[model samples]
Target: MAGHTSKRTVGALPDTTAESPFVPVALTWLAWVLFAASVAALAVRVLFGGDWAIPGVVAVDGLTVLMWVVVTFFSGIVHSYSRRYVAGTAHETRFFVLVFGFTVTVMGLVAADHLALFGLLWLSMGLLMAKLIGLARGWRQARAAARVARRHFAASSGLLAVALAALWWETGATTVSGIAAAADTPGGSVWLVAAGALVLAAMIQSALIPFHTWLLSSMTAPTPASALMHAGFVNAGGILLTRFAPVVTVDSALMLAVVAVGGASAIGGKLLKSVRTDIKAKLGCSTVGQMGFMIMQVGLGFFGAAITHLILHGFYKAYQFLSSGERVEHTAPDGGTGATIGRVASVGGVVVTLLTGLAGGALFAVLTGKGLRVDSGLLLTFFVAFTTLHAARDAVQQTSLPAAARYAAVPVAFLPAIVVYAVVYEGVSALLTVEPVSTELTVLHVVIAAVFVGIYVGIETGVHENSRRLYVALLNAGQPSSDTVMTATEEYNEY
Candidate 1:
């Protein structure tokens, strides 16, 4: 009788039949209006090919308008989803307000020209997101998670502040545009300091590698907030780098360092995700990797590609986070990840899969003129080819498929996806019209490529799984702090 009563009590906590708060509805409508305005801005840019700016205050360029569209669209979706998602919950009002604030703040951030305004918006974005992370005010774990996130944001803000001040001091310019205008003049110590600060700031904001713990701890946030956080908030790092592309690209050494860090985070994030049993933890780890790729694109001097990547990633991650609860857990019939672990493919089959990836990369080069040169474009092409190779490997490794079917899967299904990606890349690059940033081919590139491929092969072939120490390390590294985890049923009372 006591057990039955406890079950009833637990089930009744949700109160899903209760009406949703009105705040989210208003925010949802407003968000759509903001999205529409962004669309208008895009149309204007397309027709005029001119940036709209107030000189030292705010600016509207291709990057700004594009981000506005992506940010507001994600905002609208999150708000709309929350109308029912958080219905009757104590956090409903506060959550909607913060979401709206974050959305508008990002819109302001993308347009901000003044260093002061940009920094303020950036700081505000972090603060508001931290609050959303701790939305379950009654839950101690939630509050602890929020604190963890707040500290990370504070550190990121400080780094950005230092970068902005250094840039201003060096250039005697208080605006991002003015600083860009002064970029032709060499900045000595100040440039190095500013660029280093910018990279660190972006890294923390995007939650790459060592900075990713805050994000992992922030699973206490509501689903809609989680969606917005992953989709819109985190993408700010890429936006920051792209906005200051003129600054970051001026130094090859800095760009190379950024690429190396991005590469490490990319590989690290993937490995971390493999160790997580929780869905949100997995997604958080995945975000780190995605952000790594975005930063890598920025490091490559292809700011347009970085922007496109963030935009696409935002959409995909938003869907994943929001729809996460709908996931139905299942097991493979014969155990494992539903793939034959020891299946061997003929050498001819391996070549065909590899050739398909090469074809896709070749198509990308033709469409975007990226890989034709030995500069950073070669690495970009290699990444594309590598992705296609992974896709082909997945298809070929599926033991459920016949050998013939597996061999044909790459050209039939995956190649078109690469084509679409190339076309989009071309369109985005045209809009941004940024001169590609280049670094001379270096030994660093070769080493990075070799290490990345080796790790990937090891993981794909179950080499890493064989190492108990490696799995244990990743599992521990991916975990949130002890105080941030709910250990008791009462601690989960927030519902």
Candidate 2:
């Protein structure tokens, strides 16, 4: 049998000549209005250092303002892009409404001071997103994907409800700040259960491994919707943990569990991503990995670092999804001939990564006149090491430069990257007033980092001969069951 073909093109440029141009123009203007408000809110926070409150229900702090700025800025971009991308689609107006509603709910979620209000907005946002995912009315795959996402998200909502009820019952608090203040007074068992529930909710929302199928399936949605989902909504888990940091951080057991799940998801997602043939699916898997890293930062009690990672990853994923249509296939170098160079590059890259991280941490310490905290410094170092090494390996593989020049230049490139990362790390930490929780490194952190480095090196250096088998397994791991697709398709056809 021939493969099924989509009647609707995935990223085709829609004709605006026949359509009312006001739809996009109006949406774009609305997005910018929200963007301007976010900026004003941020400015007020920076200048006053006081929160703007809406009586007893909402409060806008630096974090809230910052996320507002982020969500609006990205949503504005996606809205404008969609002007041309989905201009003439049958559901263009409906698409705009869904996007606008989702954006507003997210902004509300960030600004919500009251826990009940936040929960309401959170559930609303999930519902809007599900509608957006299934917007491609007749597409069976799209409907199936939406069903998968809704099922997982509904489970997440239930967990969140339980957590919120527990928190409210224990602390007798209605607002986030109030809850945080009262959190310290709660007994150990109650706090532990609440924190555990929060972590599980985060895992489901962020699509951490085992709960990650929805993300992979969600690729059937349009690019703009996918972009917004990844960039704006997926980070809710990190935001949730950060917002409730005072409460969540008190439980060491919960923190360790977060780390364990995050570490597993990070490695697993990357493994799956490397093997995926579809570009959007690859991006989805990558989002899973990035969210894992973000959650890992939260687990390490580096809420500031987690926020930074969330923002950075959100922007990166948005850009990746928006530009996914322009992707071109590139053949990798012949492994036989490139193997030696790749191996050397991998080792050299690791050294450069370590040196860069050390230098960066030292500089940050010197400038701030504070000693480096072991956990935060190590977490930062792990990221810098892994990313820089991966980039170095890829660059060496692709470049035709002489071995001498390539080897010489790799280390030289590390100085600027390290300096920039160090500066940003310090800046964010100061701006957020994040203090290091521990001066000593834990065994778990060390083991996780080592395992990550080992896996990365094995992949980069072609040391693992069974990589092909592993990749195949990962690919199979991500595939939806045929029953799911067929059932959804049959149901849709009947309609």
Candidate 3:
């Protein structure tokens, strides 16, 4: 574990392509806009049923758009910070191009309603993310990350293929809707088994818990990639579950299994988050936890919660990963007043919100006997408590240490907005039976707040000493310029 520091400096953002200008920034933004439009269309479809109303596929598209928007924002921040951090570099062009390519494939994946279309897009995204990792960091370990990604992609492909084969055997068709809709009338068992197997594939991609090593290895990528993969790409698995809700809801045992995996990952993520020292690693674990929450929502038949969590977690995590310590400014010891009533109110508001969720979930669980006690709601409670305490403690310690220019106001200012938003969102969700309130949704809203608190704590405790060390590590993670693929491919052609 790395030591926590109050004063840290992020490396300057790299602009590797200023001279070459290979990929135009305008084109990048254009791609982002199209992606955003696609996402908005999907969200509208989710809100109101559409022509091609495959809810799961629609949800994926919507979430992809939202995640891409998040990445766009992060890219802007990274660009701004890099002016001072990275200065000048030749690889930035390649970096952005690969990033754009990666996101484009992800968009295609979201829009894919057919099984074959999905497989193509999914594999493409994996390839592009791996390529971007190597381009951005040039790390010796980038090759390792790429290897893990390939294994994951292959496993996913195999699972999907098995599902398809089973479908063909059962009903002589591989279409997602066709397999299930016709399953009961004729030979359905193959379709059921195939669907079950595909669910496992989704789990692998989601990085729930046991299959989380690929995600950990991916942390070696640049911050933009980390934010995109963790917050955006990883959510695809949950989106897949939501996409196949028709099949999932019918099988009680399968739904329960999904719930089980989601619960375990949520709990596991919160626990792992406590002990992690690497900044991005902590965020990655949180990504796992958030995915758990999304999966639980899908498993429990709460589509709204799944989308809402995806949108909220995606933006914040991306921002936190990219911006990090960039916003901090060292201040005099007596620059600001000590903790105020507002901070207290903010913390108190968070606690109250969490308690409200737990009470709601507990009541629902007792009355309906539907969900597990260890699902997303319970994990969210733990997240809130853990993050709030850590953030407040870090804030206090940083101020007292007189290390960096204390920008206490930055975090402190957000308190009122969070409290107000939580109150309104929860109150309204309760009032409207249309979007039935659940322990899971309540849990998500609070956890989003907790994410903010976690970032504050990470910045305060990490930016001082650890952040600089992190920068050094990140810079060193890049591979040497001369170590291109051609050189390695030729040298190891035998293997």
lDDT of 3 at 2: 43
Question: Which candidate number has the best TM-score?
Answer: 1
The TM-score that candidate 2 achieves is 0.87
Where does candidate 2 have its weakest 10-residue lDDT segment? 486-495
Runs in model 1 lying further than 4 Å from the true structure: 1-20, 330-349, 398-403
**Candidate 2, 35-152: lDDT as tens digits:** 9988987787777787778866997777788899999999998888888777766787888888988899999998898888988988888888888877887777677777888888
lDDT, candidates in the order shown: 0.85, 0.76, 0.56
Candidate 2: which stretches are off by over 4 Å? 1-21, 330-376, 400-414, 431-436, 463-469, 481-495
Q: What is the lDDT of residue 84 in candidate 3?
A: 31
Which whole-number lDDT from 0 to 100 does residue 282 have in model 3?
Answer: 69
Task: Please provide, for model 1 over 75-120, each residue's C-alpha lDDT reduced to its tens digit, 9 standing for 90 to 100.
Answer: 8888777877777777777888899998889889999999999999
For residue 4, model 2's alpha carbon misses the true position, in angstroms, by 23
Number of the candidate with higher TM-score, 1 or 3: 1
Best-to-worst order by lDDT is 1, 2, 3
For residues 1-495, could you state the per-residue lDDT of candidate 3 as single tens digits? 246566657554455446435354544555656656655654664577334446534323333444445445544444443333323455656666676666566656655656677677767776777675555443555665677767776787688677667766766654555544664554456656876877887878888777776776675466666766766777777666655555555555566567667766775665556445456666777777778777766665565456556657777876777765565445445676332112322444345434443444444434333344554444433443343444444344343433222334324533443354345335323322223223333444445545545644444344423445644543333222222223343232110
- Candidate 1, TM-score vs. the true structure? 0.93
For model 2, state the Cα shift of residue 229 in Å. 1.6
